[model samples]
Target: MNVVHILAALSEPTRLTAIHIIWDGGEHCVCELMERLNATQSRMSRHMGVLKAAGLVVDRRDAQWVRYRRNPDLPQSAACIVDAVIAATDVAGEVAA
Candidate 1:
């Protein structure tokens, strides 16, 4: 994973919100994300694209739905960046729980 690129992706507020939704809920479909984030598909997908490009998110095909999950094997910098984001939001406990 390109750590720099991943960190860049995560540097945006809306994308960070997307990460929080994905990381907190574990694997989730696009629709699930839409509901949780109250975002349009186009907007949600835009954020997902950034995460995918960063190699911080992975996808699975299940029927017509595409599910997304965190890529735990991400580069060190990406992991650290995510860790800090979660810590700042007090969302890391949701991850552990």
Candidate 2:
């Protein structure tokens, strides 16, 4: 986990927006992300790709619905920082399995 890379990704405005949405909304599907960000699937996918690569998020597929949520098992200072922000503002209260 490159801490610099993770910070770089989250520091982007669009990705920060996505993170706030996901952090508040709990797990979200691709459609939810699109609607929330007012972004195309390709755009959202690109942002999600960055987050995933940063080890800051995780996705679980239930049927055809892929739910994206904050990653709890990532070993990085960046993950800790993101988790702190999320926890401080975590309206989700609890992360779903």
Best by lDDT: 1
Query: CA lDDT, every prediction?
Result: 0.77, 0.74
Residue 11 CA displacement from its true place in model 1, Å = 2.4
Ten residues in sequence with the least summed lDDT for candidate 2:
88-97
Q: How well is each residue in 1-97 modelled by candidate 1, as lDDT tens digits?
A: 6767867887766677678777763898988888866778898888899899888898898997788998867767767778786667644444234
Instruction: Provide backbone clash counts, one per model.
Output: 0, 0
Off by over 4 Å in 2: 63-65, 83-97
What residue pairs are clashing in model 2?
none
What are the per-residue Cα lDDT tens digits for candidate 2 across 1-97? Answer: 8877877777666677778777653788978888866788888889899998888889898786567987777776765777666556433332211
Kindly report the root-mean-square deviation of model 2 from the true structure over all alpha carbons: 6.7
For model 1, what is the alpha-carbon lDDT of residue 53? Answer: 84
